[model samples]
Target: MTASTLARRGLGVTVVERSGDTGRTGAALSVPEGLLERITGLRSEQLPRTLAPGVQSWFAVHTALHAAAAADLGIHFRENTRVVEVGQDTDAAWAVTAEGERIHADILVGADGHRSVTRRHVAPDKSDARYAGQVLWIGVAEESAIGSRGWPASVAFQHGAGYTLIGYPLPGADGSTAPGARRLGWALYDSSRDDVLRGSGALVGSVVQHTLTAPEIPEHTFEELARDARRAFSGTWRDAMVDSIRRRAVIGTPVAEYVPDRLVRGRVALVGDAAHVANPMTGRGFAESLLDAESLGAALSSNPGRGDRTRALLHYELDRLDAVREFVRSGR
Candidate 1:
């Protein structure tokens, strides 16, 4: 997002990614009207119609942003490049890749992620994002598989027995909202899964290691989730969930939260999960990342050259650090 936003301000960006052609699943995003245009500086007509405002697939939003970044001539991607270390001197910030290539820019933006290497350089004392006390079981169900049922007009919330479920309607992959073409996306927050996480080694002490896919989940765990769905949710939400369970389409993500002690240092800065990780249940992570990019771009929009990079970055930190800290702390 920082890449596209900086590109919007006509700054060249070299994105150092760990992999090429990445994918995500089992999550929904709140895409506000003109969100894509705001993030990418791309015209609405140039974006995919599937990226319209409303609840959207996480994968769809990511793909759209990747496409938008690709379309921008100012943005350059170094796919499959891993940044092992990040540093900055008085003049500039740079990243050292695994292949020994030191990529330097006028200013380096570490939009890396929750497990950010850049974060290590920015806040060494508070480098890791600690695991929150819940695991989110996320899934998407095809309306066609669920048969005839009244479609959800808006987001639904159900809370019972230490469990919270949020279910919302999403357009089909083709952006169709018709009865037969729509989809259901749900996230179930279970606070009683600490043992499973520890046993699977997906959680070490308090840090999250990975998300658990269906293939990795124990059969009894799926059974328990299915049983809980019937007890905790009702009506269409329950039906969609039961179907998803039967199909074993769920993935368990041990939630993590981070309160930033700092978001910037010198010419290097942090954004998104790299800076602060909010509670997933707040549904604010994606939007907050957009805000980070927007604020970063706006902060540096005027400082085109490298004369005052530190001041501009400090301004970005001042703009976001407190707000993002409050957002994360409140979501807890």
Candidate 2:
């Protein structure tokens, strides 16, 4: 988003992605109306609608579309490039890629996400993300499968003894909302420390990690999750839960949060999850990231050339720091 905004303002922007292509995941996300307008310069009516009201699109579609837009704006994207380290001197900041290439820029924006190397370079003493003591298991299934069981197009929430389940409709893989083509995305949150994390060996400090497609997730785990869902929910929701668990891959991750003391150091600036990682309960992670990109671009554009660039960057950090704090507080 920063690259697209800067490129639109006629600034030379290069995006370094560690992946070979725009990565796609089965997980779905809500794109807020305000973020849609700010990033695309389009109103709600002008944007593609989602099955869920007020959401612009899912994560995969948004990613692909944003990448295409950035490409059209002449932003250079260097794929298969991983930044091993970030360094800056008085004159400029630089990133050292894993391939031993030094890329220099007057300003270094660390949009590298939660495990940011740039954040380490800028604020070495900052605290790491803390686990929120909950694990989330997520999967998606065909809407038809759920609808046939009489599930309505609405958000459903169920709480068991020690778990919470949320299910909602998402557009199809191609971003379609047509009947039988839509998808149901569900997340089951379990706070009980059970065999799932222990068997996977994903407990790294406080954070637990396990992808749906990873081999560590044994088949019995899925069966257990499905069985638990059946025992917790009733009717269409229960049936849908079982079907989704049986048919789709289930991804798991420990809920975590990280709010840094500061957002800038020297010529380096942090954005998105690099600066603050709010709980998913807030449903504002992606929105906050977009706002950070917009704020950074606006700050840089307001101070063209090298003169007063540092001041503008600091202003950007200050502009967003309060909002980020509010988000973290409210989410907690």
Candidate 3:
């Protein structure tokens, strides 16, 4: 989003993507209509046709954004580039890739996710997002895999057996909303999974290490989740969860919360999850990330020169810090 916005503002952007693939799993995204247009000032025909509003799969949204950024000549994209170190001086900011290549720019913005390495340079004192003491077991199940007698509810919240399940009727990755083509996306919040998280190293000493993939999930844990699903839900929700569990398609992610005290240092600035990470329960993390990207671009554009780089970045930090802090604290 930052790349698109910056590129549209006539600024050159180099996006260093940590991974080349977009098959990542995430909760459903609330994409407002014309989001890409709003960010890039591009017409509908200029963006990917697969880009649509409403509830979308994470993969779908990413694919569209990738397409949009790639189409812009001002945006240079590097795939599978792991940035190990980020540094900045008065004249320029740069990233040292794992391959030992240093990519320099007038100003560097870190749009990296929760485990952002760029955040370390921006706010070294508070780089890690603290573990929120709960884990979310999330997955998307196809309608054909878990047939329902009627159309599923648009959304549902169920609680039992020390778990809270959030289920949503999601369109297919292809954006199909037909009864047999739609999918069910579910997130099972379980506070009792700290042992599993610690054992899997997904949680370490109050910080999040990583997500637990299906293959890493223990047999006993799967069995327990299956039973818990039965006790907690019925009909479509239960069926979807059981199907995903039987197929071992779920991912367990420990929630992390980060409230930044500062978002910029020298010529380096932080955006998205690198800046703030609110609890997912607020359903405002993604929206806040979008605003961060937009705000950063606007602030920099308002002071578009090397001489005013630090001032622009400080403006972005000051503009966002107050609200995002409230997001994490209040949501928790």
Candidate 4:
């Protein structure tokens, strides 16, 4: 989205992605209503029918969120263009080599996910991706199937002590889908080091499989799972929360990591999870991504001169750094 906004405003914007397509299959995204309105020009109701409407004001729980509609803005996204290296051209414009092709642009924005290639190119001395000691398993179920009203309703939450499971409605597909087809989703959070879960994809897989067996289970079951799912840990999960999640659930793991530095040189910047990732507990990634696009676009628009633009990039980095640093601290 930021790439498109920059290009539309007359900046040379090119996006390089590793995937062959952008709309890859995955769970729906939750975005803020205002961000959606500002970017896409769509009111909440105007969002894709498939998007479920969850509470927009809460982060402790998940919901079906909307992104603003920016009809005038569209980006030509290229898939399968993995950024292998990043450097500066003699003129100081950012040069990026992806796959086998090379690209030169006035500025570079890394919207890549957590394991960002741009971060490595700009700051090779940085540490490896660190895990956030928590995992989230998400899936959608019918709203009515659960015999519940619609959005604004809390599915279930067990925030006792160290473990938690939050459930909420996300918007859904068109009429072909049922009403309560209101996306029922949940996140299972456990705190532990990644090494403890080492090579235990099978163990993680089994735990998720077990979660689906019942409509609800004691949250303590989750605490046990969290501990047994890896090496010994003192962390605990609520019992009632685990039971509720098990009743209707889909399993997933939301791994977290962050880049200590926000800016890569003067010409390159990182956004979204590529810059910093908050614990899924914050549920703020989508909101931050939209804001990032707006901030970067405004900075470039305000400072068109090379010198001013370079400084603008620095300002942009500083602004996001403050926000991301706070996000990291809050998650801790």
Candidate 5:
């Protein structure tokens, strides 16, 4: 989507990715209404039919329930493109090589990921990515598993001994088409870095075990942990949300990280989690990434001959720094 947006403005764009295919496997994340409205330029009438039915209400991390309307937009995900190296010359053009194929452009954008190769190649001296002492397990739960609508449809942060569990339903892909189900976001806390490296089920098992074995789970109340799948999800609500998590499914450990200083380097820039990743505890990554793409696209497209593309890049970097910081602080 970012590449297409930038390309429409006559900017040269070649998306280089490491994946051999578009791995559309991860659970859906949030896209804030204000950002969505601005980016897609759609009205309230256009939203309902365009959006998925699972989104019930717009709940904030610190605020009240509100209605959010958004425009219809599609993200064109490209696969099989892996960017291995990025180099900028004196001419201000970037030379990017991926899978032995080289492409030259006046600007580079690394929307790759947290362990961004472009970031490492450009800002080698930057501090290492740190874990936020939490590992998240995410998957879809059947509507049958959830009997009632106990909490808001958004994120619920359940804090316990040495950790926090964040639960939320991912819109649309709740498996409602053939079999009705809802996506569940579980952010469990872990003190050991070693445990996080071991992956999802281990992390979840640790959470279950923690709640069962530990006498006192700090900050986490039994009310948070005591949601019986049959009663709370399936038996109570007319439209119940259930557990979609399959037996022994691995929902990769989500370790939080961020880049506070900048969002780009030379011709290369970053969007999405590659640039600034917030803890899932905040539940704002998808919203922020979509915003970044639109903001960067607007800056690049609107300003022509304004001291080169770097000026726009710098603007994007500066604009997002404070927002990312604020989001991170709130999650903490």
Candidate 6:
């Protein structure tokens, strides 16, 4: 996104990604009205519309849309390339890839993610991301499979003893609203302790874990999740939850937050989760990333040339830091 925004400003930009393909892990995202235009110079109506009041779409669809726009603007992309470290000299900033390739730039933007290598180099002394004592199991269910469950088109939430369930509609695979073409997106939040997860044999590793696909989840765990859903939700919401659990691929991740003491250092600037990571409860992760990219582009475009680039980066950091802090605090 940062690369695309910069490219639109007539700046030469290159994006280095470790994955061979674009990210497809995230499920649905709700985008507030006007955010698309504010961030990407694209109208919200240009994308698929969701049954959920405002704009909502699959995360992959949103990503592909922005990626296409960026490509149209002539931004360069390097896939399957892993960046191990980021370093900057008095003149330029550079990324050292695992393959031992060095890519230099006038200014390096670390939009890597919550576990950003650039962030580690930029602020070695900063605290690491902290777990927020919750894990979210997310999935999508075909509306056709859901049958006549009478699910609401708008977002709905149900709070349980130690968890919460959120449901909303998503555009279909083709980004359409036709019957049997839409999907119901759902997330189940479990706020139990690590001991509970461990006892259930679910916490197999790190603080943050993802299953990627539903079939990969243990049968026992899936059964327990379904039982829990029955207890927490009712009517169509519960039906949607069970349908998604049984029919769709699922992904789970421990909620975590990271707020860096600084967002910029020398010629390097951090954006998105690289600078701050808020819990998904804020419903602002994707939106915040776009905003970060937009802000960086505006800062650089306004203060052109090498002499003012560093200062502009600092200004961008100040411009976004407070809002990020609020998001982190609120999400927790």
RMSD each, Å: 1.6, 2.6, 1.4, 7.6, 8.7, 3.1
Predicted structure 3: lDDT: 0.85
Per-candidate TM equals 0.95, 0.89, 0.96, 0.70, 0.67, 0.88
Q: How many pairs of residues collide in model 2?
A: 0
**Tens-place lDDT digits, model 1, residues 132-250:** 89999999888888865677899988897679889889998878887899889999899898999998988999998888888888899999989888987777888888988899988
> Of models 4 and 5, which has the larger TM-score?
4
Superior candidate under lDDT, 2 versus 5? 2
Runs with alpha carbons beyond 4 Å of true place in candidate 1: none
Global lDDT of each candidate? 0.87, 0.72, 0.85, 0.53, 0.50, 0.74
Clashing pairs in 2: none
Clashing pairs in 1: none
Runs off by more than 4 Å, candidate 6: 23-26, 40-55, 193-216
Alpha-carbon error at 266 in model 2, in Å?
1.6
Quick one: ranking by lDDT, best first? 1, 3, 6, 2, 4, 5
5 against 6, candidate with superior lDDT: 6
lDDT of 6 by residue, 258-296 (tens): 876888998999998888989887888877887888899
Candidate ranking under TM-score, highest first, comes to: 3, 1, 2, 6, 4, 5
Which 10 consecutive positions of candidate 2 have the poorest summed lDDT? 48-57
Per-residue accuracy of model 5 over 1-332 as CA lDDT, tens digit each: 46545654655455555565222323444545544335444455644422433332222210111122111122233346666777776455553455576666677787766667677755667624556655444334444455335524555655444444445554333223332344344434545434434432333322211111122222222223233333333322212212333332224354656645767676667777667766665667767776788788878875667357788887877777678767656766
Clashes of each: 0, 0, 0, 36, 32, 1
